[model samples]
Target: MDKRPSVLVIGDLMLDRYITGTASRLSPEAPVPVILYQSNEDRPGGAANVALNLVAMGCDVTLVGVIGEDAEGELLLSLLLSPHIDTSNIEADSQRPTTSKTRIMAGAHQVARVDREIASDVWEHHAHTFLRLVRKMLRPESIGGHPFDAVVFSDYAKGVVTEDLVRKAVENARFCGEDGIPVIVDPKRKDFRAYKGATLITPNVAEIQLATGKSVGSNEEASTVAQDVAERYECSVLLTRSEKGMLLCDKENGLKTMLITSRPVSVSDVSGAGDTVVAAVAAGLARGLDLEAACRHAEVAAEIAVSKPGTSIVTEAEIIKREAAA
Candidate 1:
């Protein structure tokens, strides 16, 4: 064993269903497209995928979030139990429906997709209950009586990660940080403000544009946006620009910055790249790495994830081998 550290992942837990077939003709019954074949199934997604990546990287992971008491939720629970993950913090709700996204693909290309979820604002009562649960999970006596090395907020803008919930998570991490725990966030739009005290925040190009209201046209532009966000939120920021690579900025450390380009790889799909980045960052923090080193590891892990098909994960050994080859 490499003495991997324990990590806590919290946010949306979803099921991703992919329909793969051949689209050889148009529909005769309506003015629309048609598929000539059929194949489909479900896979872990959102924060679940993040946790999966953490486990693949030899980290002990515990996922804390909500899931519906439906068949999909049952399947997800079963899958997690099969792994070494500690799911004692996962809450199943009969009132809310499980979040699921279905993507239709023809060969390696995605054609269309549908999302079945509830995005309306969560009730205050539910938010209070969720926060209480989270605090309990982070207490000194929970989860083998040892505090987690880090916590990750893998928000997908779903209702599960409400503003109040995010704020509570930050406060909890602040308390943990006094004792040397790190908090990393993979944030979405509405709750970005809720992650003010995070140790690190990872947002993609489009998300950075939306969050910072800046058009990143060049390297300097990327640095400026990162600096703005880091200054505003009082935390380090990492901007992942798909093919263009990534940029990191930390205001406390003389506002240092580093840009990492994507390694050469066979392109197949871009799904779950953000999840992989957050996963790698969480793993790195747990293993006693600084924000820059964690972002570098995450960049390489995301490159590996994008090269594979459909919300795939990257292993630690695979990242080491790829970096060595590079």
Candidate 2:
């Protein structure tokens, strides 16, 4: 039997398209540069990116989210399938088009971004169906009769992760008994009340400020803010500070803060770095690592993720190579 950790990711799904070209002159119609066509690339985004990062780290991943019944949705599914991510629980919505973000890049710089998505909450029936699917996937019989080791909520505030979904997930974990799995949340909403009772929530400094109305400029300030947020949410908090690294505070640990310094690397792009961090942390927690160790692993993963362009994934090999070099 394979002992690899199995992770279930639930949230919004999107397609990230990069249109790269050369820009020599500005468009007469607008202030934007005229990008000469070069090439285009597409990759899974949002929660799907979390699953991709987990898979690259050699974990068994199952992704559940909502996508449209359009061609963009088909393309997104195809890309996910290519990575061997289990998309069996993804539901298609006919009322909205698939969420897609197209970045117009000139050489290495992004010139403009075009977004296509429905910002409203999913329909009531869709939410019900999504909850049903979540319950089914959480069952032991869903994947070779083995329960998932971890559950990740990758919320983009795109409406796939509803308050009911988060509540149901917590209830499901409780139903799993003593081995109650860890539920990790990558929160994006300004109001984080829905995420209460989760095992851990990984939010960046800016997100922390947005949710808690507190700014984190230094290590001590971040620690104070993390404790406040953790107490409010009644769970552990991993506060990701781009260059300053990560700060973790948990009530289980008596709210004693732990800091993990960031690894030195030249960042190429910060897109999807949050997803990578949460994925690494989830994988580590699923494999039974402590929060501190998991956060350390996540820091390394984030370092590698930002070193690449666009939405990228960090493999186990890359982590090993970086470790050896360090």
**Model 2 regions more than 4 Å off:** 82-84, 139-146
Q: For model 2, which pairs clash?
A: none
In Å, residue 98's CA in model 2 sits off its true spot by: 0.5
Worst 10 residues of 2 by lDDT: 137-146
What is the lDDT, from 0 to 100, of the residue 37 in candidate 1? Answer: 62
- Expressed as tens digits, the lDDT of each residue in 228-321 for candidate 2 is 8889888899999998888889778899998888878898999999999999999999888988888888988999999999999899788778
TM-score of 1: 0.93
Which residue pairs of candidate 1 clash? none
lDDT of each: 0.82, 0.89
The best candidate by lDDT is 2
Task: Write down the TM-score for model 2.
Answer: 0.95
Q: What TM-score does each of the candidates earn?
A: 0.93, 0.95
